[model samples]
Target: MPNARISLPKAKLSAVLGHLAKIPASLSMTTIQTSPDGLWLYQSGHGLDVQLCFPEARTESRVTTSVNTAALAQMVSVAPGEAVEVEVGPSGLKFGTGGYRASLNGLIVDYDEPPIEAEGGVVVPIAELGRAIRCVRHAVGGVNRPHFRGVQLEFSPGNLRAVASDGYRLARYDLGVDGPLNGKAMLPLKPLDAALGILSTQDGAATLQLHGGRLAVIGEAVRLALTPMGQGLPNVENAIPKSYVAEAIVDPRALIQAIRRVSLLSPQDNRRIDLSFSEQRLEVRGAGDYGEGRDEVPLDTYRGEPLALSLNAVYLYDALSCIEGMARIKISDPRSPIAVEALEDARYLGVIAPILNP
Candidate 1:
């Protein structure tokens, strides 16, 4: 029942508070739970729970009160390099540095401990996990369909896979790890996005705990938990053809630039772009009311017969942007799904369904 005071570097406090500010506004509780060790702020709603703990803060006594996440972040953001002193009293929480001080009233709410279980999870490099998330996040669909709004994570003894799809396109990223893991889970897009933001501020490693119907990501100063989608993800492996009749190898950067140039002429409503590839050149064409545009990019290698396919410009661009060095566009036919693989890294793959009518 005594006032609790804590002190931390302004930049550190600001960084942690920035993550807390990302929590959905729909979540009710906005309280800060403090103990002798550090301060905690948590919020849960829409099947996702996020908590940020400042374990490095120097604390005295104990307190439980809620403060405005935005206000706290703003206060610290302006404080810059100074050390911030946070004192929790009956009236509210006070934030101060060398010359500036401000107070905000705290909200009273019953705080329940967040269900975060980090046991039996694999320790993965933060950079690797972040890369995997970015590779597939764009493919995740909107909230209208709950099942397609998440990324599927498949784990084996030495392999970890992340897959996401929006019915039209799918992304799969495989990572090798030395750990004991054998299961599959779906991680909602919102929490996954939030986890990525938190992970960006951290270095070294992060623990991924998946058990029951929940997935918890434990980072340096942040912890995120979310309920996995109940419905099963589509069998993505089957969607990718075992072999291709034609393969066109092109520089990823050139392909990306060509797509962007042609897409400028594509209509806003029907943004379809045609990719015609033969032995020497890969031509990208787009037509609309605004007229048409075309760009021919030289290919490194082209195998099999000529192939022409129409696809959503955005979808193709998204797939191409994720690839690093060279990209191979493998096609069985114009009607069948087209496969995109990164030449530098075989672990990342993308599939986009062609616009059959176009």
Candidate 2:
């Protein structure tokens, strides 16, 4: 009967749409639902589902429609700092920004409210929390295993832990929180990646709510709802060794550089890097069909029996990149899992399964 219209600042709308752009095209969830109150976008595929919402003041006209998500995101990205005016009428939806204006065809879909469990969710500081997630996300496994494709978040009194493993390497990060929290959830990678990207652009704190098989991340400019993995994560905590026969404390940056040089000779497939520790130094060696490389760095402290282990060079780099200052490597034997610790921050830990035949 009447045209419905709403206005939004270009920067805010672009940020929200940028998150939606991360969602791949899907037959069921590619459309963005718009209403008098705000905008909505949902994407579901494989075993993961994600929903993003941007709420604003309600307009008098109760118009509702769905538009292509990519189209809207592209339009807003090119017009930064300008105001956007959206009008929905019988013909289609009109998008106007600055001197540019265009019309997009719309579809009508049944809009069901997303189930959000905000009760008793822990509040986490955005800056540190976002950094922690980014550091560990690289270790998450591929889509073949749904359970390993997500990050395990454990919330306890005064602390929040993030853990991820790809069977070969595991990453753990710990952050302090105010008050108490008691819950654990496996968050899918897609939504977690989007949430991290959104949080990077904003300030202040974000709330994490996990209930009823859903995880909701409420931020300043956006809200995200994600489906938790149905299966349980592997018992990684038990795999960490309680005692070590060999320990070496060395500078993380120096070790990282040495590993990078040796990795140049690593095979493309396995990318093996051999680590040898003695009383005086730590030697990193890599050999492949093409060539061989080796580099040794002095260790601040070394004790116990001599130990050597072979592992994926990239995995070691990924684990070390997250740490600062001195890093301690504890080993029971060449066959057992090696524990990597940041001496400065006891809250951070990494484990890499050694290569058996190497």
Candidate 3:
């Protein structure tokens, strides 16, 4: 005899698993809880934590059962039809639909934990959230520095700004909106991704709840929260130069294309491309063991002194890719970092360190 049985829509269950899977697999058991509210799948380990709730899942009574996460994920992925029926019994757990039965062993035990307190969070617009996460994702740190691996978010009553740096390059996005939170917080990619991924399934999902050193994305049907990576957070603002002279305004598409075409003849080892700006035209030069190449692009405007600087072609290309229509290339000197700004959208910014060549 089973203690309880519940039928969950296949689509809903699979969606919940998709979010839970983002949590790094750990020996810490993945458990599901049943109560009057709904079914909650909980998993946490290695500085990442996530909780997903299915408010629609029916339950006969209250119970928390440790489950084989891999088995459950596989079953949900291949399970057929609109709904799948699951039962908890003394011998094991059973799954099937329409009279078919697939019995899988389960660990039945008493588990107790308080629900994620999802209250008193500020409403962050979905557009701002997307912009902040996407721009920073491309520029986060490598394994060289653990602190560089996360992005810092500063919230004020007027706007929200997010910045990320990978030592070589940095990116930031600013959006104007009314936000309740104040002060700056450093959040690792794990929790941000989990929040964004789970939010995609929900309609009209807004607000991020920060409680107990964890950040959560709350939605109508499902909610997820993960721990923030707060230690040794990099000081990014000081590294970004405050003053830059706009040297040239150019179309990003043409510039990116010119770099690709000119780098073909350059060596594969460095991929270092030199930029020489004068008058209304800019020259891109690349040299490698194979040979050398140069291409010229027309600039909309030019200012400051005649400028010549070198940088990795890949880095500049990525920085330019994020800009909108017209991009201003600003530089203070050959020894300083370069700034790429989107004239159309002042909210986005990118900085790349110049490669000093003798």
Candidate 4:
């Protein structure tokens, strides 16, 4: 028998959706099995029987059918109780749910065009897309803020770039793609993420078109369109001065592991990691109710004057892990912001602001 999936109406819809978020977004192949009891979605990688947990409600409905993971992701914005019309096709499947729909003429858009273009078009690897998208998604504001907590995507034909900062932690990743778009724009994390949820399941390189502030992703069997937030993102190049140049070399994972261990002792709300430079050594310190713990990491070589600066451990950890290489890191000053460059290569660059109180 062919496998199928059913969408059951829920009493507590938010809870149901939250649970779904934990499931891998790329598991697009699912079977909706309906039996005497109710409905069950059978898919690889998920263990144990799945049950719908719902509170009291007036009415609920479940639709049992097979759906591509990308098709299910398109319904992310649709509210419960809303009707989702589904139909199958030979080339690609079509469905209307949540924030997306199929046109009356039967035109299905899995991909939208980009606002601008590069020479040959930008081709990004699936794993790179997943890592960069995941890091920045957490920094995007759940609720809209005036100009902060948004994601800035920049392409220069030579590099595909993404950055997200919420005035607390800033995350950025730059990787080589087919085309690094010279143009840039800001898009809310939610929609870009929805697009990635569709991409994560596919293999090979993905093509992107950035035009009119809209991004379209062309994949093997799926296409994704994401409307940019449209507010002009700050000129990231000028957000911090280019002259705050000081250099220190360290391992990406070493710093990450050290901070992760120390952060366990730091308060979540007021987490602080202090860095002090002594000769060629870097000292990391953090304090909490359990007192303070300190760890020293050796630096490859230090340039300029020694300094002590305190930063949010969580933010530094987040930034360091994003970059690849056990190499040098450049800093302007303890008071000024920090910029990270990959020593092994120049695939991407990262910048972060210093915490005032940390």
Model 3, position 54, has a per-residue lDDT of: 72
Positional deviation of 93 in candidate 4, in angstroms? 14
Clashes of 4: 29
Residue-by-residue lDDT tens digits, candidate 3, 1-358: 2366777888867875676666666563567777677777777765655566677776767766777776777777676788888876544467878766687666776667655566766666665677677776678886777787877776777787888888888898886666567766677777677666666656664666667777666666555666667663556677678886647899999999999988886667667889998888999998887788889999999998888998889888888887768998888888899888897888888898888866
Find the candidate with the highest TM-score and give its number: 1
lDDT tens readout by residue for model 2, 1-358? 4776767667876876677567555543344555555655555544445455556634556555566667768766775346778776544578776677788777765557554446566787788888788778878988886669989888888888898988878888887775456777888787677667766766677787765666677666455666777764788887787788999999999999999999999989989999989999999999999899999999999998888889999888888888888999889888988888898888788998888892
Ranking by lDDT: 1, 2, 3, 4
The clash numbers for all candidates, in the given order, read: 1, 0, 1, 29
Candidate No. with top lDDT: 1
Off by over 4 Å in 1: 25-28, 80-82, 108-115
- Tell me the lDDT of candidate 4: 0.57
lDDT score for candidate 2 against the true structure: 0.76
RMSD of each: 2.3, 3.3, 3.3, 12.3
What would the per-residue lDDT of candidate 4 be over residues 325-347, giving only the tens digit for each residue?
66556678777778766788665
lDDT of 1: 0.80
What is candidate 1's CA lDDT for residue 120? Answer: 70
Model with the higher TM-score, candidate 1 or 2: 1
